[model samples]
Target: MADDIREMSFEQAIAELEQVVGQLDSGDVPLERSIDLYDRGAKLKAHCEVKLREAEEKVEQITLDAKGQPTGTRPAEGM
Candidate 1:
């Protein structure tokens, strides 16, 4: 589970998180399983956040020329 979760792409993490939310929302999961799902959900949420922040930083670092076209990328700062 550790390797699999850590390796999941952003999309995969998000989709699994949504499914975990659905199961928890339905109130049909056993208490024990719900607790386990909640833990996984927390990890997934953190992973998603990290992925989003990395993407945001990349977007921020795009160097633009006078015409506002992307010239290239700059080094991301304050990472």
Candidate 2:
């Protein structure tokens, strides 16, 4: 489920969030709907944050070590 959510584009995430907000605002949905919306919203928020972090890391030219783990060093500075 998380992997599927992560595959969604930013636009898709925003669209889903809008739907969630609408459902929450309507106050007509059952408890299950509210819970589902809340869960989806949480996932969307996390996905957006991850994407933003990755973009920032890329712009900063961050690189990973041989094991594909971040070296914890900034770009243009030796690891």
Candidate 3:
């Protein structure tokens, strides 16, 4: 993955991935370009998965009080 891709937010990565999928599905890109797009799409998908995992971990960190109110976030487990 390029450094630029690593710096992209999840939304940006997902948008580009969707565009790449659309282009590949259309079957109009030349073979070389299709290969490049597929590679980029794979990287974008991985990045998105990592972002989602981070989000899920954060969600799991929410500390609840006796009344089930959110008190604060605890450290992510097994970090």
Best by lDDT: 3
| Candidate 2, RMSD to the unseen true structure | 8.8
Compute each candidate's TM-score over C-alphas: 0.75, 0.65, 0.77
Candidate 3 runs further than 4 Å off: 61-79
Poorest lDDT segment (10 consecutive residues) of candidate 1: 53-62
- Comparing 2 and 3 on TM-score, the stronger one: 3
Please report, in order, the local distance difference test score of every candidate based on alpha carbons.
Answer: 0.90, 0.78, 0.91
How do the residues 1-79 of candidate 1 rate in per-residue lDDT, one tens digit apiece?
A: 4677889999999999999999999999999999999999999999999898888777658799999999988877775
Model 2 Cα lDDT, one tens digit per residue, 5-39: 87898778778888888888899989997998899
- Candidate 2: deviation at residue 62, Å? 16
Per-residue lDDT, model 1, residue 4, is: 79
- lDDT for model 3 comes to 0.91
**Cα deviation in Å at residue 6, candidate 3?**
0.5
